[model samples]
Target: MSEQLITPWAESRPLPPYKGVLAVDAKDFTGLPAVLHAPVSQMIPELVDQAMARAGLTSVLQDKRFPANTGDGIVFGFDPAHLPFVIWPFLKELDEVLAQYNLSVGPRIRLRASVHVGPLPDEGRPDDGNGTPRNDTHRLLDSRPVKAVLASSSEQTTHLAAILSDRVYEDVVLGGYAGLHPDRCIEVPATVEGKPFAQRAWLFIPSPSGNLFRAGVLAAEAPGGPAEPADAPAQRSGRSYRGNTQNVREGTAVMGDVSGNVSHTSGDTRYTATNQHWGSGDNVSGTKNTAAPGEQR
Candidate 1:
């Protein structure tokens, strides 16, 4: 047999802090025996590359750390701005790939993904590095909210659950352009080994209706806490974090004689139906007539 040689990274520059760190682990992969590891290890990189390319982010997977044959997952440190279009869409495609694999085989190769933004410390290995942010991202995969969402999705058509750190939510998803609704995300505390890791990470699942997963409304506590109260008000409109709402149907006021009115607000102003009359006490401004009765405005 010939002697083997190992190559190093062409650019061994010091690893810098990344604005967003993505960590993903195959759920229940450890329970498999050694023989099964090789297939998963070999397939993951290809799957990741394909998914990233599909999302038009082919470069994001280039320098990232992928799991070895015995390892359990992959880690990526990238620009925070990519979270909305690049990373989020990549995850959606990734889920499709994994779900297809499950359909091809008998068992599902579900993935639990977590995203966080922070400084990353160099581990001296360009290929694989670990730091506080990466660890927190991994620990977030073990969070109760993530696990619960994953379990809930098992019976559904999709088998992926993504958890976003508070910073990612506030800065990216909440900032806009993610194509995801804030109401679809629920704040959940991320805990690992019975200790709190992230105080208010957001959890989301692609909806089974061929849309993003539904996280439903969540309570204000860590995993295994009390359920949402019965009196919690339901969201009547499909309003994203900072997006505009277009009312298509007439809204009925319970106690007032305002009749039925449809209203929508985009920025700094509110527009209502012309048929409806609003009093000064209603505090509504900029009423414009864009639609007739029973027509979307």
Candidate 2:
């Protein structure tokens, strides 16, 4: 006989409806001194509550539906219709909240948020929000594109780095419903470490930080502490060179069919982008005969 496809409890409950999912996690939470961990962890929800109040999302918080904490962060599952609200006022309000908190508090608080929409069956949902959508939500939150946005930026200036699923990006941002501008978002590959997951996603940063800021007098204070040249290569998404190719950002990173080594000056490390897909393949040691992926140097 074939194995049962329907579980006993699931058969009785009506199908769960698709829902909007949003998650926020602190950057470098583990880097804090152990003593400050408790106070910091305790503030995640309180700050969220304050943001909700500002976004007028207090009703959902009152319902306390699908709220889960992932040690250093929190997740909220809600009706898909509210996704736009979460994307706009909620995210903006949260960014403001974090900026204020970091200014007045010790152990600066920076965050990475992910927005997704999917079903969370009543009975089958994991206790800590481990459904596929929420899992993907976390994967996006942990993805390097988003992390690089935060990492490459100044923690004091950059408050939040948010990732959006292609669906949400289309339905909310591109649909002209979100306060987030379309041009501000960059497409990226959303993947997880040690996990079988890959998808195209979008990234948004509310405030400019480090190397991502627009060029101007402010550029001088950006990550590298200097303004970039007018002829610098345009920023590319995901890994470098569009393949296993090395992107020579030192002078010219123009894409080509041939493989070559790349080098940079002392301060040029700021321009050298680390490939999130297969790790950094930059040949900065000033040597010939670089090894290919998985080969001994």
Candidate 3:
């Protein structure tokens, strides 16, 4: 039940918006088996190096592990747009290579991306160690618009990934506990051989980091309506709302016997007997002696 923590990848570094350009927070990794709880700390660094080498991007990155307060692990970050197009192919290749180690990419190891078109901030060089610049308020203000966009993108990607991946993949989306919101979400139905698949869709959550978490799977179904009304009578019994008695015959009262047998009785005399168990057998009984005038029977 780990959740992801959201923090600025770089402190005091201004990020500006660019059209058709994306920023991604990516981590390099080889797959590890589920039984191994502690993975090599060098795994992320090695992956990053491999990505940089393949993309031919000459950039310096800090080698520090930012530990979570809860002691889960640390998160690494990089600028995706700074890397060459080969970055994507490199990751795919890494996945194939790691398969040999009986490890692949960790499910939780994903990139959050953000794409925006806007102006970037420009940082000035330091002066003669005097009052050069107390703070880069200019860059901070300029990067605000773009930074906000990227933050939103990361949230959307995380949410979509959570919904699409299998239940086991929850570890990835949940992160180490800081819940994020998803915006600009899109769900597309999945198909096989040009035919629709039942309860399946493709989700897209574009992060400012230029990272897109993609997966294919079945979608969750909506629950059915409430349970049927409990007042419904049993189907086996042919009794109506007025009880088992079908048609009224004079002043007879429809009585149900111990075995649920229905019969008609007028006063102290049984007129007809109908045994439902015997398939509708009716027996005519003797009628009560009619009392003379007002005399009681």
Candidate that scores best on lDDT: 2
lDDT (Cα, tens digit) per residue for candidate 1, span 1-297: 954643558546655666577777777777878788767766666676677888888556664543233256666677666778643687788878776776775445777788887766545465444566777877888876677556645444757788888888887789886877665676654545445453557777653322221222222333565333344235523212222122111122111112244454545433443332211112122233333354322
Candidate 2, 1-297: lDDT as tens digits = 965566676556664667788888899999999998888888988898898899998777775556877779888777777788888888888889999988884788888999998777644444534468878888899875678667767777789888999989998889998777766676665655456666778877777664454311022333544333444346522223322233222222222222343333444222232221211222222223344564322
Give the winner by TM-score: 1 or 3.
1
Q: Which candidate is the best by TM-score?
A: 2
Q: Give residue 99's lDDT in candidate 3 (0 to 100).
A: 35
Query: What TM-score would each prediction reach against the true structure?
Result: 0.60, 0.69, 0.24
TM-score of the candidate numbered 2? 0.69
lDDT of 1 at 32: 78
lDDT assessment of candidate 1: 0.58
lDDT of 3 at 110: 43
lDDT agreement of model 3 with the native: 0.27
> By TM-score, how accurate is candidate 1?
0.60
- For model 2, the stretches where C-alpha displacement exceeds 4 angstroms are 1-15, 123-130, 214-297
The number of clashing residue pairs in model 1 is 5
